[model samples]
Target: MALLEVHDLVVEFPTRRGVLTAVDEISLHIDEGEVLGVVGESGAGKSMTGNAIIGLLEPPGRIARGEILLDGRRIDNLPYDQMRTIRGKEIGAIFQDPLTSLNPLYTVGEQLVETIQTHTDMTPTQARARALELLIEVGIPAPERRVDQYPHQFSGGMRQRVVIALALCVNPRLIVADEPTTALDVSIQAQIIALLKRLCSEHGTAVMLVTHDMGVIAETADRVAVMYAGRIAEVGPVKQVVKRARHPYTHGLMGSIPVIGHDADRLTQIEGAMPRLTDIPTGCAFNPRCPQATDRCLRDRPEPMPTEDGQVACWLFEKEAAHV
Candidate 1:
């Protein structure tokens, strides 16, 4: 069975003007040890999906419909206290900024030991040893000394490694990593990506990696889900989606990425911006920006239809296939 499942999930916000749907009927899954990348521009609801899964959605924004399941059991309806127990123990989260995720007041060792103790019956000594081992596991040098230091003492990359260690304190079955590498430079980003991939392979931990950077997705994710204006435009294996995207939105996204051997002087650029929540297009949310959009695309929203690799929500999949 899939490690995590999200079925027809909808996240909405109650506004003074009216209710705004931030995530519209999104559905996807991730298997054990698989990294499912949710990629899109800002406001595409990728991070919102992760937050919903992790039960961290800001107040006033809520799951209006559908369900989230983990290990074949429904988790969306789980009581707050019960879900709290499950979070660090069963599902971990790594965010974009390590600074916000880590507490500055406490030593890194204190935080890790607390988490370990919370989920296990280990003694303080045991927990501290475990914490040190975790720091070393995450590639923190001088874990002996660094463990006692506050979050501020570490570099951006090293602090992110600490966050990774904290997330894996109990060896959670899955992790919802939301833009985990955006705060770092290209080299640091690659290092974190490698670390995540290595962890998944070693520990069989599934990942829901949400990001706007296609480059990260290409490197880290096994499957790719392309979202536009809160809806999934396409989802498939990383290789297929990256090389033979079926939906125009996915195609545009793939085209925008720089290729190693390609001689193109300019990267492909999508013509328009993502639509605002207040003014999403009537049919496909991407119709306004999609160059191949047709009358049907502008008039009727398409649900996910089967593609060779996975599924795509587009009326032009036929033409796309022909082009392919």
Candidate 2:
């Protein structure tokens, strides 16, 4: 069975104007030890999906509909205390900003030890040793001394490593890494991605990586799901999705990539901006920016249809033309 299965998840925010649907009936699955990359621009609902799964969405935003299943058990409806028990034990999360996730007042060692002790039956000494070991494994220098320092003392990259160590404290079965490298420099970004991939492989942890960088998805993901507006526009194997993109939005993204020999006056860009959650169009959400959009696209929403190599939610690949 898949380690995590999200079915028809919908999260909405109540506004003075009306209810805005940030995520609409989105569903996906991650199997044990597999890396599923959820890629899209900002406001694409990727992070919202992660937050919903971890039960971290605050007031104003709520789960309008859906099921978050972990190992065949439904978790979305669990009580607060029961869900708290699962949050760190069954699932771990690493966000874009390490400092925001880590407590400023506490020593890094204290937070890590607290997490380890909360989820496991380890004694204080054992937890302390494990915490130090994890900090070193994540590439933090002077694991012994550094552990005693506060979050502000570490560099951005070093702090992020500590965050990774904290997430792995419970030996979670699933890891939700929501743009974990977004706040770092390019040089440090690669290192963070490598660390996540290596640790997941070593611990047999399933990962759902939400990011805007296609390069990161191509490099770290076994499979890719592209979200447009609030719904999935395309999904399939990473290689097939990257090299043989079927959705117009996906094609536009690839066209913008700076290739070695391709010399163009300007980098190709998707012509328009994504619609606001409050002003989503009548039919296909991407029709306004999609080059291949037709009248049918603006008049009727196209369901996700199977392509030869992938699945895309666009009229360009209508089933009537598939046989021909």
Candidate 3:
């Protein structure tokens, strides 16, 4: 069974004007020790999906429909207290800004020990030793001494490493990492990504990595899900989606990536901006920006249909499937 399953999830917000759907019916899964990259433009609901899975959606924003299951057990309906316990124990979370995720007031050791103790039956001494080991595992130098330092003491990259350590302290089965490298230097981003890949592989931890950087996804993920305007445009193995995208939106996203040796006057770009949640158009949310959009695309939303090796939600694919 898939380690993590998100089925037909619809995240909505109750606004004074009307209800706004931030995430439409989207589904995906991740297996143990695999990285599933969720990539899209900003405001594409990548982070929102991660937050929903980790039970961290702010007030007014809620899962209006569908379900989230971890290890074949429904967690979307679990009470706040139960879900709180599950957060650090069953599922870990790493956010874009390490500074925001880590408490500046507490020593790194204190935080890691607390998280470890909460989920495991380890004594304080054992938890502290584990915390130090985790810091070393994540490549923090001299973890024995660094463990007692505050968040402010570490460099940006080192602080992120600490956040990653805290996330893994409880030995969670899955992790929801939302833009975990966005706040770091370009050089540091690669190191952090490598660290996550190595540690998760060693521990057999599944990852839901949410980001806007296609390069990061290409490097770290086994599979990729391309989201656009709150819906999944395409999903498949990382190699296929990166090299042979089917949906126009996914194609545009891949094209927008700057190739190292290629010379161009300007990078390829999609014509229109993502729709605002309050003003999402009828039918396929991507129709307004899709170059291959048809009348059917503007009038009727398409469900995910099988493609060469993955799935794409597009009327064009549906018609092609019909002929087959």
| Residue pairs with clashing backbones, model 1 | none
Please count the clashing residue pairs in each candidate, in the order shown.
0, 0, 0
Model 2 per-residue lDDT tens digits across residues 75-128: 998999999999889999999987587899999999999999999999999999
Please identify model 1 stretches exceeding 4 Å from their true place.
318-324
The sequence of per-residue lDDT tens digits that candidate 1 reaches over residues 1-324 is 998999999999999999999999999999988999999999999999999999889989999999999999999988899999999888999999986779999999999999999999999999999999999899999999999999998889999999999999999999999999998988889999999889877999999999999888888889999999999989999999988888888888888888898899999999979999999989888888889888998999988877767889998775554443
Top-TM-score candidate index: 3
lDDT of every predicted structure (CA atoms): 0.91, 0.91, 0.91
Model 2 stretches astray by more than 4 angstroms: 320-324
TM accuracy, model 2: 0.97
Which regions of candidate 3 fall more than 4 Å away from where they truly are?
A: 322-324
TM-score of each: 0.97, 0.97, 0.97
Compute the lDDT of residue 202 as modeled in candidate 1.
93
The per-prediction CA RMSD against the true structure, in angstroms, equals: 2.0, 1.6, 1.2
